[model samples]
Target: MTEKDFIPKRYSESMEHGSVSWEAPSNIALVKYWGKKEHQIPANPSVSFTLKNCRTITRLDFSKKENQSDFDFEIYFEGNKKEDFKPKIKTFFERIVQYVPFLKEYKFEIHSENTFPHSSGIASSASGMSALALCVMSLEKKLNPEMREGFFRKKASFLARLGSGSACRSIEGDLVVWGKHQETRGSSDLFGIKYPDEVHENFKNYQDTILLVDKGTKEVSSSVGHNLMHNHPFAEARFAQAHENLAKLKPVFAEGDLEKFIEIVENEALTLHSMMMSSRPYFILMKPNTLEIINKIWSFRKRTELPVCFTLDAGANVHVLYPEKDKVKVLEFIKNELVAYCENGHYICDSVGDGALKLK
Candidate 1:
């Protein structure tokens, strides 16, 4: 999609200096999306739990600037200037400038800080882009008082999707689904929608302990990995499997079937990496420690009769998921066994969150 497609009918008004801050959480995909289509649309539908604690808090300070044809903005990460992050933010503004025309008339000082460290195998894009989207949409609402709250969030999700596909899912809480599926209602390829509340409470308040297997950057970026799927021998079959699993998972979630939940979640995680390995130019994103953690998690679950499972993103870290009821046992296991495999024994304990927050 282009900027021309997002322009509102009215952009004749301008506002003075003001700042908006928002905190948006990262998400862990239970049904992984490995490929995409045009406009950053996912090739397959995916579901994820919105994570708390591991989030990005962003503040946008806007000031009236002299006549300028383009957006004038500076970005800071953790109080430090981030020249590297400017290109993506610049491109994102260019794509959505039509919707917020006053962006060109203002100079912005953006300060963003993540709760978790960068390149730690967490989905920073999901939190960062969603937080920015919330800030921009908050500014737009101030300019146009008639904008409804629901529309503001939907638009933010749409804008976030343009910046990063999975970022759209970060706009909602508890659980979210992106990409249209024949059986899912309200699902769209443009943006994500929160999962229905009909889901069992057992799935709510799920704990996720992110074991930092490797704190370094991913060997192959998610973008490059998605591109590789174009020539992957199993791409089509993988997409089909995702659809089938999502369908099965919906009922499993409503039925509160922990066994099925563990089955689907773990399978999805492994399938994601398997696709990467089977690609035309094969690569492995998982480290030896990642496998060790997974194996240990399996053994622990079998031995203790606890309902726990592991999922990985497009990186080497392990996300250990379990119900809130098992928190004590899970934490004890993580501290005793999993910590040994983690990088310097670092891990972020997080859980399902209530979506993004607008800071006062």
Candidate 2:
């Protein structure tokens, strides 16, 4: 899609002061986006489920500033000043300054908080950046009252991508697809598109219970990992495989094929880590307990014939996914068998959620 796809009108009136807030959810890719290019574009398409409960809420209070070219903002996280986050937010503001011209006229107070641990395997950047994007756009639409809803969301997603690639997907709820594809209409390398309505009802409300194996910060950052993929031997083949898997998984979503879903999701999870290990200066993000949890999940699945499956992000924590109908048994299994593997028996129970919410 081009700029014409979403048109925001130029407004003559400028708001002297405004405040906007939004809550955006994190997402886990079923078909992973492990590589990228310039401007945060994905090397291959990815599909993910929007997670509930695990989210970030961000509020921006803006007021007029005289002759300011750079960002003037103070940010707080969970009632504490986050001086460390200022640099990233500054970079984000610089990248998006052109698109949002009125930003120069404003000084901002940005307050943000997360529902889950920051670096413990969850995509904190995804939820954080998207929430901030939503708040910014919400304030923008106040200035330009003519901004349409589609334009508003697409613009927010586009801006979010500049901060974090997965953050674009967090702008929409349920299932979101990012990256260009021959079969997916309106899919873009610039922003995420919500999965089509062709999805089967059975896939709705899917459960994702995260087992926090280690709460410590990751050894290698996601940015460094993406950089490693640049010279990865399997880069070409891996990208191709992602396209193929995405094509295959669409039908599975529409048909509600749990068996195929398990296969595709599990493969995507492992493929993510495999690429990391294959990098020239490789690293391992998974802990010993990660494998142990996987084995137990598989063994339990085999014994009881349940549909439970596991997927991982860039860290050691395992997200155990299954359908809501099997919640009782799954929770029981987690309590009895999986809690031992998690750090301090810590885990989060979450499910599919409605995307970002604009606060009144």
Worst 10 residues of 2 by lDDT: 3-12
Please report, in order, the local distance difference test score of every candidate based on alpha carbons.
Answer: 0.90, 0.90
Top-TM-score structure, candidate number: 2
* Candidate 2 C-alpha lDDT tens digits along 122-199: 769999999998988887888788778998999999999999999999999899999998788888898998987488
lDDT of 1 at 174: 86
Q: Which portions of model 2 show Cα errors greater than 4 Å?
A: 3-9
**Ten residues in sequence with the least summed lDDT for candidate 1:** 1-10
Q: What is the per-residue lDDT of model 1 for residues 1-360, given as tens digits with 9 covering 90 to 100?
A: 333545677844468889999999999999999999877889999999999899999999998888787888899999899999999999888877767777798899999999988767676999999999999998888888887777777789999988998999999998999888887888888888888637898988999999999998887899999989887889999999999998998888888999999999999999999999998789999999999999999999999989999999999999999999999989999999889998888999999998999999
Off by over 4 Å in 1: 1-6, 11-13
CA RMSD of each candidate after superposition:
1.8, 1.4
TM-score of candidate 2 against the unseen true structure: 0.97
Clashes per model (N, Cα, C within 3 A): 0, 0
TM-score of candidate 1 on Cα atoms, chains taken together = 0.96
